[model samples]
Target: MTHNVAILGASGYTGAELVRLISQHPDIQIAALAAERKAGMEMADVFPHLRHLSLPTLCKIGEIDFSTIDLCFCALPHKTSQEVISALPADLKIVDLSADFRLSDPEEYEKWYGNPHSAVEMQKEAVYGLTEFNREAIANARLVAGTGCNAATGQFVLRPLIAADVIDLDDIILDMKCAVSGAGRALKENLLHAELSEGYNAYALGSTHRHLGEFDEQFSAIAGRPVKVQFTPHLLPVNRGILATTYVKGDAKAIYAALEAAYKDEPFVELLPFGQGPSTHNVRGSNFVHIGVAEDRLEGRAIVIAALDNLTKGSSGQALQNANLMLGLEETAGLMMAPLFP
Candidate 1:
């Protein structure tokens, strides 16, 4: 059966990405494109790369007939997402690509996002959308919150180890490098080509990065304790992908085995041979996540590295993955394409 889908915030990076992927999908049709600021503009005009494909013109959210939209992907920015999603039809299946519904508690949401959640009831119903870990919940959920790209990358490496108790939770550290597109399509002085092209620097030091909230909430829940890892994110000069190098105190061999066993049957996750590291290039433009494990020279230590396209597997691809479960479609539908390689 064909599912009619609407994409809100259709002009943003993730929103455009959803269009790109969904356009190629066999069971889903793009029925509406909502980009408030760019309403009435042709999608091809806004994104020349998409000019080859026929698509709906951008329009205001209210103009779209939700009665015809079987599913919606909300790629709107943080504060705005909650407000908009709160008013959608209660029965519509939604995959939200914002931080608005990630945290379970309103207090924690305010603590991290700096505002009270306006949709308390919706927050109570939204399922966390880490596809591999929360498959069952996502399948039954009316709303699924896509995790931050960095958070998704890090969790791909750490969640298994944490669950198996193979690592020391107190000493975990994550050093991640993310591409500029992960910052979204907004205009910013720091994201300028002249400024960001040749240099890379870390921001949100001292565990202040907002994704840390997701890490804290997810990891702690798995471990049944307060588990906070030291996380620092660096912005890379490239356009896509995320490479997260995690340091943990554990038996390297055991950690590798744990990860290998955890994702053995999972379709999107690939574990490299022991001691072999992954590069962002391998998973670029694909929904695949390549993970590697290296035994440090020091005994009882391991370095776990994970790589994936920040825009694909980290956001849009993830949203689509959850949408498949919600719609009772094949879990891997429209996402089996190979990575774009040089």
Candidate 2:
């Protein structure tokens, strides 16, 4: 059962990652590669690291043969993904690595993205691709929306606590730090090596980061009430990974027990020993998320930390996990690689 796959934005960081992972997958074949600006060039020309594989030449999405592709990984940008996916064949199964279909509410989508959703019909059918929490929904979904990297990291730490009622819902705060690769392969003056290499700083202060829309929507639904957390993201100097430190109001022991109990049977999620925190380097380039819980200075309050490679567990790897479920393959197929260690 070799699944024939296509990547729509095959030249970006996440797109290249999808290629790297699928190239090693025993049950998946890279059938097509589409990069509008880089069309007509070989994948090796766009990414020399992938020179070893015999991949398809880059082309435009309009030129792809959807009838031959069993699955498509839409790695296009936010607004662009919706436009392109709207034009794709309705029968084609898709795992969109964009923000377009993540939020179920179109109004919320517009509020964050500043435009109406052009593909509302598909949005209604797309499952939120959290992999671990949404496994059953993803298995039956024709379209799956990959969660935002920061949102995924924060949720991995808080969702279990919320679900188990181990923490006070009104006082959750997520302070996350992410690597530069999460910004994608696009060029920006601020992203220049000289400017970003030696410094780290927080941005999107207050509740303004776009991934907050996902947190608001998902956490609220899980608690059967509105759940809003104060979230702030920092830009780190490194190239990959996300470390989310969460501050919650709860008993330290209960928080630790809740997280361990929730993910004890899950393969990709690892709960570190109580009182020990995780670091970004520990989960580099892998689908695993390591989480830890400890007591905060304030009584009855706990600090939770979660770490994972933003590009893997946070994006492409998560997409592959959902795809496995959709295809009825083993949920962990082609995703058993251990995290890169120093």
Candidate 3:
């Protein structure tokens, strides 16, 4: 059986990525594409790379017929998604790719996002869309919230450790390097070629990155207490992927064991051999996550790393993963393509 899905913000990078992946899906079809600012323009024109494929002309969200859509992927921006999703059909199954529904508490959402969540009712029902950690719940959810690319990468390394009690919970540090595309396709002076090329710098320092809200919420839930990691994010000049290097006081053997056991059966997450590490180049343009663990100079300290394409596994691909389970389709369908590498 085939499913017809619509993309609510098809003009952006994530939306175009959804189109590229779904074009090869055996059980899903792109029914409509909406791009408010670019309404009435061809998707191909907006994204020249997609010119060869046939896709709907970008339309405003109001023009979409929600009833015909089996599921809708809302790739709209943070605050914008709340308003749009709040007004969407009540019965429409949705996989939101924005930060709008990711945090369960409206108060917490306001704390991190700087605005009260407008869709409190729907927010309460949304399932966190980390396919590895919350697969069963995602399968039955009508509203699935995709994790932030940075948040998702960090969790991939820490969740298992927290669950297995392999790492020192109170003293964890995450140093992340994210590609510029992770900032989104929106034009910004800092993202320009002249400004960003051959240069790298840290932005959200001193544990001020917004994704930390997710870390606090999820880690705390797992450990049954408040768990906050020292997190600092840097902007890399590269065009794709996120690599999170996490420091923890734990037995290297145990850290590797916990991670290995957790992702042993996960199709998209790969655990590198002990002492080996992963690079962003290995996971570009794919939903795969490569994790590695190594011992620090200090005997009890360990370093855990995780890497994935910020745009693919980090956002659009993750949205599709949840959308698959929500529709009762195989969780891995439409997402098994190999990573692009030089």
**Once all C-alphas are superposed, what RMSD does model 1 give against the true structure?**
0.6
Candidate 1, TM-score vs. the true structure? 0.99
Model 2, 1-342: lDDT tens digits are 798999999999999999888887888899999999999999999999999999999998889889999999999999999999988898999999999999999999999989999998888999999988988899999999999999999999989899999999999888899999999999998999998988989998996789999999999999999999999899999989999999999999998998888899999999998899999889998999999888998999999999999999999999999988887888888888988888
Please report, in order, the local distance difference test score of every candidate based on alpha carbons.
Answer: 0.95, 0.93, 0.93
Poorest stretch of ten by lDDT in candidate 3: 204-213
The TM-score obtained by model 2 is: 0.99
Those runs of model 3 whose alpha carbons end farther than 4 Å from true positions after fitting are: none
Local error of candidate 3 at residue 185 (angstroms):
1.4
Q: What is the lDDT of candidate 3?
A: 0.93
Model 3, residue 85: distance off in Å is 0.9
Ranking by TM-score: 1, 3, 2
In candidate 3, what are the lDDT values of residues 174-202, reduced to their tens digit?
99999998888889999999999989899
TM-score for each predicted model, relative to the true structure: 0.99, 0.99, 0.99
Clashes of each: 0, 0, 0
- In model 1, state the lDDT of residue 337: 91
Query: Distance from true position, residue 224, model 3, in Å?
Result: 0.4
Error of 2 at 109 (Å): 0.4
**List of clashing residue pairs for candidate 1:** none
